[model samples]
Target: MLIFSKAKLVFLSMPKTGTTAYETALSPFASQYVCDPPELKHAPVYRYNRFFRPMLEKFVSPDIETLAVVREPIDWLGSWYRYRHRPFLAGKPTSTAGMSFDAFVQAYCKGSRPAFANVGSQVNFVKPQPNGTKVDHLFRYENQSGLLTFLEERLGIKIELARENVSPAMPLSLSPEVEEKLRRKCAEEFELWESIT
Candidate 1:
């Protein structure tokens, strides 16, 4: 997460949405940047509301707004699938070494997901908190220009992005049956993505 105190903006790092590149590009301008201990780095709305919100409100500003980027659902899952396919995770329970994209996504749609398909939901990551805290600005990952324009105008600085922490490229094909199951089981994921104009 990157916090620009002066701008009263906090960029929430939604996993697999290419926030790492934003973090890298904006770190120098941010008042605070949390990039370690994956849990904190990728703290969702609830986590931020619990941990960072109170502190920032007290010490920085009470009007801090949050920004988050969400990717197309299937593409997001594919990133996770390919990421775990990396050689480093070859033998781990979380590895997707021999799994087809269909199997991986089917696992993800399960009530109790297997380790390899346990990537957290993007919908949950940006869900509104009980106290009204929420993502004030949301962007689609595919719309880089829109996000960059918002950031540049808000921060009053020119911006550039470099790809970072990208998953390895692979040909992923999800069978129609599995895809249908995923959409049925995880409708919120699709709904949330579509809602991000």
Candidate 2:
């Protein structure tokens, strides 16, 4: 997460949505950047509301707005599948080395997901809190230009992003059956992505 106090903006890092690049590019201008400890680095809306919000409101500005980027649902899951399929995770429980993309996604739709398919939901990551704390600005991962424009205009600085923490390139496909199941089971994921115009 990157907090630009002067701009009253907090960029929430939504996983697998190419947020690492933004964090890298914006860190120099940010008053605070949290990159260590994956949990804190990727703290979702609820986590932020519970932990960071109060402190930030008291010390910084109470009107801080949040920004988040969300990728298309299938592409986001594919990224996770490819990432865990890396050789470095070969022996870990979270490894997806031998699994097909279909199997990985099927596992993700299960009531109790296996570690390899346990990538958290993007919708949940930015869901609105009961008190209405939520992402004030949301962008699609594919629309880099739109996001960059917003950031540059808001921060009053030129912006550039470099690819960071990218998953391996791999051909991934899901069977129609599995795709249907995923959509049915995780409708919110698709809905959230669609809602981000």
Candidate 3:
């Protein structure tokens, strides 16, 4: 997560949404940067509300605009599947080695997901808090230019991002049956992604 005090913006890092690249390029300009410890780096709305909001409200500004990026649901899952397939994770319970994309997604659709498919939901990550804290600007991960434009204009700086934390490329094909099950079970993921302008 990156917080700009003067800009009054909090950039929430949604997993697999190219946030690492943003952090790399923009961290120097941010007033506060939380990049260490994956738990804090990817703190969701509820966690931010609990741990960071109060301090920001008191010390920085009470009204901070939150921003986040949501990737297309299937593509997001594919990233996770391919990421875990990296050689470093081979043989680990959380690894996707030797697993087909269809099987990985099917596991994701289960009521109790297996370790390899236990990635968190983007919808829950950006959901509005009880106090009405919500994302003020939400961007699609595919719209990198749009997000960069918004950031440049908002922060008064030229933005340059280098690709980072990319999973290895692989042909990912989900069977229709598994895709249907995923859409049915995770409708909110698609809905949230579609809602972004």
Candidate 4:
């Protein structure tokens, strides 16, 4: 279940799904925000499932609207690759920057992943707000326009996003071998994301 309220909307940040971009664009709307400064950035009443929903509902303004953004598994996985393994960050000779789509697919197939480091664990999933209110808005990262339309229509605000954590610095498609591996590795999540797409 996904949930959000206008008084406090929680961004369940799945790594590399453009959380930074969304946060930047949407900050003006939030009453409080974490990951931003105190002057302009309002802290979350709470960010995660930290407190009971009814308890939060009581405190937050009645008009809060909550939202989240998601992306396709294939592209999302590709971005995860660039974000994690890029050599530029360490300023080394830029070689072996990204894993083969095949190898990355194989690694993702393993069920368990470390909390923040692994691909599937950080992404490929969504977490619900406490007490499980259905999400008011779900945006598709693959279709930024669609997401923007959704938010504008519902929230009555126009948003322009400058995306950080951008991936596919050089846009590359997955090979057939890699595609099949991905299809096989993330069957369940692929199906779900496909439906969303």
On lDDT, the leading prediction is 1
lDDT of candidates 1 onward, in order: 0.95, 0.93, 0.94, 0.56
**lDDT measured at residue 185 in model 4 versus the true structure, 0 to 100:** 65
Candidate 1 per-residue lDDT over residues 15-119, each given as its tens digit: 899999999999999999999889999999999999999999999998989999999999999999999999999999999998899999988988999899999
Off by over 4 Å in 2: none
User: What lDDT score goes with residue 38 in model 1?
Assistant: 95
Clashing residue pairs, candidate 1? none
Off by over 4 Å in 3: none
User: Could you give candidate 3's per-residue lDDT for residues 63-120 as a string of tens digits?
Assistant: 8888999999999999999999999999899999998999999999998999999999
For all predicted structures, in order, the TM-scores are 0.99, 0.98, 0.98, 0.69
Model 3 residue 179 lDDT score: 92
After TM-score superposition, the amount by which residue 46's alpha carbon in candidate 3 deviates from its true location, in angstroms, is 0.3
* Ranking of models by lDDT: 1, 3, 2, 4
- Candidate 2 lDDT, tens digit per residue, 1-197? 99999999999998999989989898999999999799999999999999999999999999999999999999999999999999989989999998899999989999999889889999889989999999999999999999999999999999887899999999988999999999999999999989988
Query: Please, what are the lDDT tens digits per residue for candidate 4 over residues 1-197?
Result: 12335525555455566767877777677554456343122222233334434555678654445555667777777676666556564433322254465565556666764322254432224444456654455667677788777666655688888867576475556778768876776676666566564
